[model samples]
Target: MYKTSTKIHLYTVRSQMRPALLLSMTLFSLLMLSSCKKGSPGSVNDPGTEPQPVADAAFLQVSTSELNTMAIDNKNVLWFAGDNRGAVSGLGNKNKNVSFVRVADQVKSVSVSDSRSMIIKSDNSVWTSGDNGFGELGIGNAVSNGNFVKVADEAEQIEAGWENGFIIKPDHSLWASGFNHYQIFNSSYSLADVVDTYQKIADNVQAISVGQAHVLMLKTDGSLWVCGQNVNGQLGTGNNTEQRGFVKIMDGVKAIEACSYHSLIIKTDNSLWATGHNEYGELGIGNNTDQNRFVKVMDNVSALAGGRFFSMAIKNDGTLWASGYNNQTFGITGPDQNKFIKVADNVTAVAASEYHSMMIKSDKTLWATGSNTYGEIGAGSERSLSVFTKVKLK
Candidate 1:
């Protein structure tokens, strides 16, 4: 629980003190009051002193990670509900109110798709849980693991897709193992490859983002590479051709993210770009037309997240924005927002799942809005929240 008090307690002394001492005390009190920032309770400026600001009852410092179906907190705790299962057994076994459970301690990073979940441990080793029907676990078998199982070592990052898993090595090379039904593995080679273990895919890969059946990779030279199902022009290669291997799409890219059928990117100029299926206007280009090539959407984007048919972004000034399919029954607001619209201010991080969204503000507090049929809102109830609400992690 959080307190809503803004009153400051002051003390008065009966005996007169020296002019110098009284003046110093007054200055200290003023400093303490001025240092209080929103979301952070208690002043550290004058610790162990009288009339100190009350410490926050809920003191959890948080950063949120939404895996398109699951969410994690700064403490490596996992929150899940709805159709997705496995990965951290019993985390949401009941299927009612959202269950509060931590996956593992010291988790360096995590990733998930519609059915699979992956995590990189503190040892620089990779572990995976959930559906593995296509050898998505990269553990030399097609069997699934309800509990996390180690698959690789010295991994810097991990990403999961509908039927594939990807990892980045300490040397910056890329490795992948799983179902390549859409030629997401070897673009120029045959699609008959069935990887049972980690197989070298590419080199000089800096980052990766995978969606339903497609993927986007950022090369060390700031060039963007893409592959997989392009039925909706998700590859953004000017045609609806499914790539055999990664094809260079653009240059001067900084970050990229994808959802079920669309992709978003942030370029070096701090501008936002989008391409692919736009049935729900997920591209945020002021229309619902599918884009075969990248189109400029907004400017000054610092970070972003893409969901099933919607997108969320954080501007350089800490304002949160959302676009794409929205209606009175679900989504951010309006029947739909073809253009970006402000949602909140002072947001430091933002994440989007299939049908919901979450964000952390500068105050280190967590807030959520959108779909909550399975209690994904972290409010410990099944009631769907159409407006932002404080997630009670405590």
Candidate 2:
């Protein structure tokens, strides 16, 4: 669900490394800490790195996609996508006080994986750059390009998966490219089925959430459909069998989120449902057992964000709750929580990554918590935080 009584998910990006045999590894034991940036090969969780200064100004808006966090400063300056060193761009970095690198002009939104990035210009055109091993850039070839290339037009929304890209048109049609190992296209995605360009896959789609190897599609009719890997019952199809085609899993769904091996579903009735990988209580069901079918979790939820093995939910009353994989990573001093724990209130939005979590409060102030191996937490240092620390936007 866009916000759910259920859990939500975000894919586990390989960071700086991309492996072609991701599916060959065990889900519970895999700890891929890869990167998309070009310069660093150090441990993503390294703690000895020197601290860097960070800008902390009020923001008008904040957004997080995958491992990137971006915000528009109150002054209209665009901050670096939060993955790179703390830098802001746009407005030409007029303020010599801040080092800004202009990414693009007239940009509306950005989506990035560990190795590639896609930008939607204000004119409704989609551009892509970086790794294109599977033609995820949608530039009509598998050759990688460092510069952004226009890939599609008249797009309404874009999403970047591990090595895949998706676009939604004004007509609500879903277009996809890149890896299809799990058959997100509703057809056999054999080794020869590498899609080098975008192709229409479904229609009447209102929203979509991509998981490590699965996808959740929300239709205008409130139907939720799923495809891709289900080794851990992530597809919520009531079995561990993989789905090679779009299969309807539930109805009256309002929003959905997918990540790594779990999914969160919000119903039109304001109820939450969760399914798939729950080894660490990512499902927030107060237990560590796995679920093959969609199970009810909580209610009164309005927003949701799922991390590698944890889940976060926001109540309509403005309270934010978190569960699963709670440790020093979440700044909590207890064992992993199988149940939801109240963390903060007045939260408006939140984004979860494999290691870090970013959120925006009602005041539009940004806060981040978790691992900071790559200075992703923007805490002015490479030290990991044990609490939701306020981060400056400017």
Candidate 3:
């Protein structure tokens, strides 16, 4: 009876061991099936999903060569200017320079359609390169460049001076580079300073302009602010004292532009105001005597552009007016008169170079005048033009 009991116990243990082994193998098979499903072709492991588009993808659409300046229109199309050329195109990822459609090639200065983008290069230094040779790059150093380098980020607009760079940040703050000979950087302005005062304005700025040494800022609320080299009375403060910090210039200002040594402001009433270095009568105050206060140029002015030592404006009726240095050497010779005089009609847009000028008509046709030594006026010659001549872009 004892032997029989032992044999039965051994058989029971063997039976239990077999069932446990089967259970382990079943679990292992299930785990392997699950892993295979996870990596299967019809499962979530597929790798064919399209990439999401970038949020500001519109900026990546257009292809511009040696883009020295850029502006976005009301339709979001991008207009860009090169070192001596310009182009307009719909925003996209196309890389064809042929589709860029050149506007001007010998350009040294450029401003945007909505008055938001400005680019300038003078004295063989690209202001946007942050090359500070003679303090021209505005980064407080004199570095050279083999190609264009973006010196700042989040810049909504930019303007260039003889050796300085000015820009409006996306946050409506102002920034300046180049020379600070007159404390344009405010009280802390210095040749070694790199911090831009727009970060200290304590308010949001709508627009800003930089003259030879002076700076102008228009606030969102229609208030005007001025700072830096005021010796020429460009600050419009009614005093000759140089402003080392931001001061109110005036109110009701809609737009502002700065030339070589002067400033132009447009009021909400459509009147134009100007001040500073008028040795050439650039202020259009009817005289060459310098004025420390803002003086009216004309009423019903719609748009204004300033050159190195001259200025131009368009009236609401589409007539164009120009003032300041119009000498044959400077390239402005439309009318024999030097003071603010009417030039042409049906003008749509105007751009000013160091000593040259360009205009686009209502028909999308372009015209230019002044110094064409480098074919900057696109008149097919190096001759200095004195009148508005049509430019063929075909």
How well is each residue in 1-394 modelled by candidate 1, as lDDT tens digits? 2334445566775466777887778888776656563334552333323233232222122222232344555555554444445443323232333633344565667776656677777788887777666777787765653667788878887887667789999898999888766666665546776676778889999899887678999998999999888889888899998876788978999999877788999999999999999888888888999998999998999998877788888999999888877642133456777778888898887777677777777776667777666555565556666777666542
lDDT of 2 by residue, 5-82 (tens): 222244575856456445544342233322312113432323444334444565554445434554555555445443
Q: What is the TM-score of candidate 3?
A: 0.63
- lDDT values, one for every candidate: 0.71, 0.71, 0.57
Deviation from truth (RMSD, Å), model 1: 10.9
TM-score preference between candidates 1 and 3, better one = 1
Where model 1 places Cα greater than 4 Å from the true spot, the runs are 1-84, 87-97, 187-193, 327-332
How much lDDT does candidate 3 score?
A: 0.57
Which one wins by TM-score: 2 or 3? 2
Worst 10 residues of 3 by lDDT: 1-10
